[model samples]
Target: MSDGTAERTNEARGRRWRGRVGLSIQSKLLIMLLAVSLASSVIVGTIGFLNGRQSLHDSAIDQLITIRSMRAAEITTALDAVKRDASLHSRNLSAQALSTSINEGFAELQQEEPEPEDRAALETYYSDVFIPELEGRTGDSYGDEAFIPDSVAGQHLQAHFTTQNQDFDADYDTLLDDNDPGDGSSYAAASEQYGDYFSRLVREAGYEDALLMNLDGDIVFSAYKGVELGSNLMSGPYRETALASAYAEAIATNSVSTVVLTDFERWIPSLNVPTMWVISPVGNDSRITGAMAFQVSIDTINALTTGDEGWKEQGLGDTGEVYLVGRDDLMRSSSRILIEDPEVYEKRAVNGGIAPSIVKRAVEVDGTVLLQPVDTQAVEDAQAGESGTTTGRDYLGGDSVTAYAPLEVEGLDWVIIARIDSAEAFAPVSEFTRTVLLSLLGILLGVSLLSLLLAQVFTRPVHRLVGAVHRVAAGDLDVQVPQGSRDEFGDLGHAFNDMASSLRIKQELIDEQQVENEKLLHTLMPESVAAKYKKGDEAISEAHENVSVVFAELIGFDDYARGLSPEQEISHLNTLMRGFDEAAEKAGVEKVRTLRGGYLASSGLVVPRVDNVRRSVDFARNLLGVVERFNAQNGTSIGLRAGVDSGTVTSGLVARTTLAYDLWGDAVNLAYRVRSVTGDPGVYVSQTVYDRTREIFTYSEAGTVEAHGGTETVWKVA
Candidate 1:
């Protein structure tokens, strides 16, 4: 045959084969199954990822809140401890005796009258550091001699000794020699021993320095610096400053027990750092000899805020830390890495997008890190006395989750902030999502291949069974599918028929159970409240007009119950309360509840009535009558103390797992408070209740009664 005839014959053969079927139901079923499985996997995997991320984020916030609270508490406790120890030292007997000796020794040195350079140095410090501090300028650099580089204040005193050692050892010896040791009590340490005693105290106390201030505010002795002797904070350049306030508070008080603490300030010349002082009186009963002021150490605070092992040891992760910020938004403590290792810290600072000022301070290049701004949202809320967690930009300009709270210090507006990088907090969740997605993709591929092999056997029977299910789903449960096909799917249709029949009967039973549940709910709460709950309302409340509220307490019941077991005690209380409930129902009043204190009941709330006041009073009296009969029967002395008040009240169901029917307003509060008036066993009615039910119940004057709001005239019901 020719080529053209061969091509025509092959095309005809292909058409004949296609005519038998275009796409078989088996192949269609396979593709559809694969598509559905892949779609379901994608949807479920996405949901799991989102939910897991949220859970992890919430956990991070909770952890940060707990960490911040612990850090703040530690700071308060540590500072208070140090302050107490220093204050005690100032009142020591040896310290007081030494103060007198030091003052006298200085006075005698004045009589010696030499050392012009020593006089000049002290006078210069007074003018440079003290005056500038009073004017409120930065005090650190102002003292020309105070910040003479690589030296403390002691260097200025070396000039007076004519010694090149640049310290006060020689001058200290001269002062001790000049001192007239009248009692010979032996404070020879003031001379030869010099700063040995003060130095030991500073080292033990962990203070930056210690100063013995004479009544005139002269720096008579110092552990680190003693250059400002004869300079008075009261009438000199340091007047009107925090140290002056501490002095005035200590010396002006009559008690030798006086110890005053000053807030933080910049100590300008000697040490260019924030300073606090604890000044305590050193005196006998007649007069204060002098005062000992110790400079508070800031290193203790830095250590506490930064944690025991620099944040990580406290479960604060790589980016997590707790630090302090003042009201002015400046850092109160040094950064963790900054204090530990500055070179490494600077690299991190740059990578973290930390502020320029903070980087400068962290490396000690500019010393501005202590004053770096912390303007995050958590800090702002904390300054307003609110404690909570939030997600926002941190001081390092990174996305972070933060917990912040105000430190409970007496005179400081500092906030403690605990935070972690969001990327670090949510990394595990992201990894989980990636794993889930990969797993879903693998399962989808496997299922698609398996479905192709199995579809031929499943399609025809499944199609017939699907129609039967659709009818059942549409509420046509009586539709009988053909179970004629001899296969597992055909058997499935028969089981489905049985399931539908059982479901219809079960549904009828559920309807009946629902009605019973409704009835049960009405028994616990007011019917109106139950109705709202049935309508899917989470909370129910309303204002009622002219409701009479009765509050009654069982006196001596709690103390009496000490004689019984836990179960028996509860049983006894329930028996008495059940009697009160019966009395309320008989009088047409509604019993709200009986809790720890007493039973609170009301009238004209669930349903209004013009005689609610009358019903309330009758209910109170009947409850007491029930109590009396019980006392006589059981040989007990339980007494009923009741109060009746009629006015507008707010009633509602407290939305909890166990619902509480309650009332509030002046009427309810007054009724409860009046129960505490006296030990009588009668119902006490307010003036409003008296006017409404006076004719029905004979009443006697209960007189002006003291209640919660104020005293008001009440009456006794007979």
Candidate 2:
């Protein structure tokens, strides 16, 4: 191949490579749109997920709170019922019948030393006659001694015995034998009758067991076991708890006391089951004689809380469980076994089967206890005697939302804790979130694909238009873009073609005008100055007082021009002043003019309508910024000195054939003198300007100076 042809081919390949390297406007736009869409999708999806999770968690907490409140209400109702029944039984027992039975039965027992056969007969006779008579009416068996019976006489006795032992023996003998029946028997029977009535009422009122204990702590009678009728309750833990609770109730002016029985047995698989006791005093003449206690089975509580009905079915899901705990933190009753750890249960059984710490903590921090999912601190704030709910990690490492409510039973400090596994509680939300995320991802993917396709479709016309414009710019005016459907891009294509045609026609005239303007501007001012004036920044008319202005003129410019032609002189001055103009501009100062072979420059508040004085000061400081830059860029010997003065100046437009606005006042004149008198070719400013800006700049006083205006204090700025 010929060398000329080979070079041409290489140049063509280079141009093609450059064209490929540059991206089309359409491609850039498509990329930006995709980036924005993806960012928006991610933000929206994250927000949706967070909002959904919060909503579900809040709902679970609310449900748990409601359940706990209901449990407290039920327990309170049961206790109140027991109290009412015990009070009624105490009030209904007649004092007269008690005295009469004791008196007459004692008299009859004293009249005979009864045989075993007689004793059996008397017991039968008393059961059939006196007991029936006493049970029939409120006052019929209440005569002084008429109601007591004897088996030998086969009749009722009518007498009174005064001795304590004789009276007790007569009462007991009359009720148990035909003769010599002790008053104790009659009193015992009466007590038994009253106790049986009391127990029956409590049982009918829904309690599983009931007991009546005297002030001395002796169990007089119990519904569950009549065998322990005469046993002293003071030795037992159950009775001790009851006594303490009763005393507390009395001091606190409360009528009921509730406590939990935490001892576990082989019968109970879980150590959490607790028995609740409600104790109320049996009173006569405003003095408490004894206390009547109602005992409810833990199983009954479980049944009530986890009934076959919709109690758990309502809002609580399948895995949700409700239970009661004593103030001592022992589980009274629960629908499910809460103690999941076998080791813990074993330890509890070995340690008296009571969770003392749990009870204390519950009372101290009356909120949900979660052991799994994650360890959380106890909710101690809930024990303020108000029902409250909280959520935390449960044992087994799962999220749980639980509610706690204080139960006001007579002798027991108990609370109901209703808990639901967070997973089960918000299963619906989890499913929904999962479904939504999947759906959104799919939708986003589909949208992205569709956007890509749409981008391709729309970019085709834009790409073609770009190619046509490039061809025209490369001098291929014959190139034409195919017209697609009438759209914005179609109009753009037509506009581009018209613009190219117009540019081709006016290229010569425009180039000639540009060349002439450049030459004329260069002759009138330095290149930097001409550029600034072209950009409409002719004079530093926006200059404020306390700003520095600098002016420099060649000392013998006229003499230098004497031997040169007009063009040579103009060119030399332009070359010399151009460096200064560039230096001032780089220093962030406005070069106002370079007229009649002189230069004028000022810095600080030079921009018209500037609102910030500090910015103006910053600009003045930065004016020195350009001087150093200029010296570094060009190894020049020339230097500039500036004078700054802090004072007011008049700023307005001046009309010549061409309009000009400039700063004119004593401050500007003084600034000029300060710059001219400077011994060194650096910056100089009046004392007023120095004072205002000294904190931010290093400077030295140039003492006082006499200028075109008047003598003023001046300082040099570095």
Q: What TM-score does model 1 achieve against the real structure? A: 0.50
Candidate number with greatest TM-score = 1
lDDT of 1 by residue, 1-718 (tens): 9966974785565446545655655457757876878687867767776777678767777777888888888988977776677667776776876788777766555455355555466456445544454335332234434322111222323333222213233433343233222323133236434445566677777777777877766666655443333455676546667888878878788567776766566564233467778887777667778888888856666668776555777888776777888888878776665655776666666666666555754465323235656778888999999998888887756688888888987656788888888878777777777877787877777787777677566666667777778888898866766555434454465567568778788889999999999889877766887778678677787777789999998887888788889998888888888888899889999888787648999998877888999999999989888888888766688888899998888776775566777789989988976666666778888888988888899988866776556778788887
For every model shown, what is its TM-score relative to the native structure? Answer: 0.50, 0.40
For this target, which candidate reaches the highest lDDT against the unseen true structure? 1
> Candidate 2 lDDT, tens digit per residue, 208-260?
45655555555444444322233345553233443345533532432323222
Segments of candidate 2 deviating more than 4 angstroms: 1-20, 24-36, 39-57, 94-199, 235-274, 286-289, 307-309, 335-379, 384-388, 395-397, 405-411, 448-718
* Candidate-wise lDDT, in order: 0.70, 0.51
